[model samples]
Target: MASTEAIAAAFRIDPQILEKWLEGKQPVLAKYASAHQQIFAQFEYIGGEWHPKLDRQSSVAMLDEPSQSQNAVESDRVQHPNSSEVDLEPQSTAMFQAVGIVTGAVHLDWETHKHSAIINGSTYPLFYISQKRKAFEALKAEVAATGNSRQRLIVYPRVIHFPNKQRAHEIAFQLVGFDKGQQTKQEVSRELLDFEFKLAGLWQFIPVCRIPCISIFRNFSSERLDYIKQAEPAKKVKFLKASHLPLLWKDAPCKPFRFNPKAEGDQGHPTFVTLKVKFLPERNVFSFVEQLTPVQETAPPFLKASKKDKASLRRQ
Candidate 1:
């Protein structure tokens, strides 16, 4: 499954934006109705729990030639198909849907039986106050009108993200309050309400993002990375590129990693190649292993031909 890092990489946003949303204190992570639908459009639900679909590329590579690979599979079957371990990379840990998440100050509402925050002239319900009531009251008390700064709510999810449209979901969130004078702000992109802007010490939003950076959730998912069955390699030797140095995966920041070699050639070990076979749980870790230098454009060799050559061509 895609991680927050993968999604961020795919959409070309910052990974930390989704990292803040990982621990959902509420049942449903909400998002903007329109943006949620847009995310769903990216993956077709295979069936059952409706796990997001995996395109063929992010798909695990299959070995076609080796009948003996079945022997490798049989050995690996001893290991459980799934793991209880959380991924080291935050993005790979879960699939989150973050869209049009508006950051604002929390104003808990007893009437609505939930907290509500106002943004862009719209009041959206913020869930999780019941569990974090103590923190909620602390926030309310911390910023009481005349303070140096106001409390901030790092709301996650948009209007559209939900289990289903028929049953609307509660938006998950976290409460962050800081001393305005001491606070320093930085972000990849987010929708900050006017007051939040002042709190962030931002005069104007820079790199205004129109699209929401959603997290790819993988809870209770029966899905597993496509099983890779490799027999023990007989040798450890491999080839290396002189210029490329230590063969690299063609990775773009926030893009799917393109490992150099597809898979092990046989029971033999791959040299000078990091087998591209495994679908890593964390995109941020492996994908950012190397930063590729930009390709500098040089005048075409053909164009650099001497005037004598040009005259020769014209005569021909």
Candidate 2:
């Protein structure tokens, strides 16, 4: 869900990185002179503030107390649940996982070219191509069905890192939940990646801290696309792409199946997965499909292409 704007603000990289990305010049970030610390962690709302919660074993998890004041949950400082352990070294792209209560209503935003959700008083983006309308309708249905229960939306994003400015530095020092003491802070220069960074031109502030900002996939699946409900194999897969691969081709980029917030199992949590961006500079276009390597089959490969080539052809 990282929009072009968020990427610019959070990182000290090229302002036109997105444009260059679309133009087929794969943007490579400046490498750190030394190894930088990166954390893959999750957080939860507890005791009127966001707390780091890595354990997923709890069946009856309480993210918010019934009597908790709305102001606390709606605070902009603690809007995100996850934290990072990044340093001042030149930042690179990384992914983080987060869960938040979906606030406000779901609606399409043409400006950002994404469906929008207000999570904890902050705006988050959802990207769905082709069947966007269907996905939007399904999300609306789930939100309405959940009513006042306040369902949680989980997202996985590959975000770019930027140097922490004055505000970000203060927020980093203000955070209170790290398990380790000051020594840990010294070793890993922990900072809040969600803090504001400078954005110019078409780049705007993107609230989601994860993907180039946050987006949906695995946890936020769509029941509308669950046509083969009883089919064990299909159901086991977390996410599904929308197109098919060609013979001798692999790793093609395709849109994911529509999301269904009301799907069974852990009804309170909806999730989404963002695919890694890829490009073909030679072709001057995004590379949706990749050519496969040669196989060592003695006989002619008759059933080869038909085998898994239909990855995108499956009925959603």
Question: Judged by TM-score, which candidate is best?
Answer: 1
Candidate that would win on lDDT: 1
- The residue-level lDDT of candidate 2 at 247 comes to 12
lDDT of 2 by residue, 171-285 (tens): 0010111112223342222321122111100101222221121221121212322322322332223112111110111332322222233455531211222222222222211
Q: After superposition, how far is residue 199 of candidate 2 from its true place, in Å?
A: 28
Clashes of 1: 24
lDDT of 2 at 219: 19
Per-prediction TM-score, please?
Answer: 0.27, 0.20
State the C-alpha lDDT per candidate. 0.27, 0.25
**TM-score, prediction 2:** 0.20
- Segments in model 2 whose C-alpha atoms lie over 4 Å from true places: 1-105, 110-112, 129-134, 141-151, 163-316
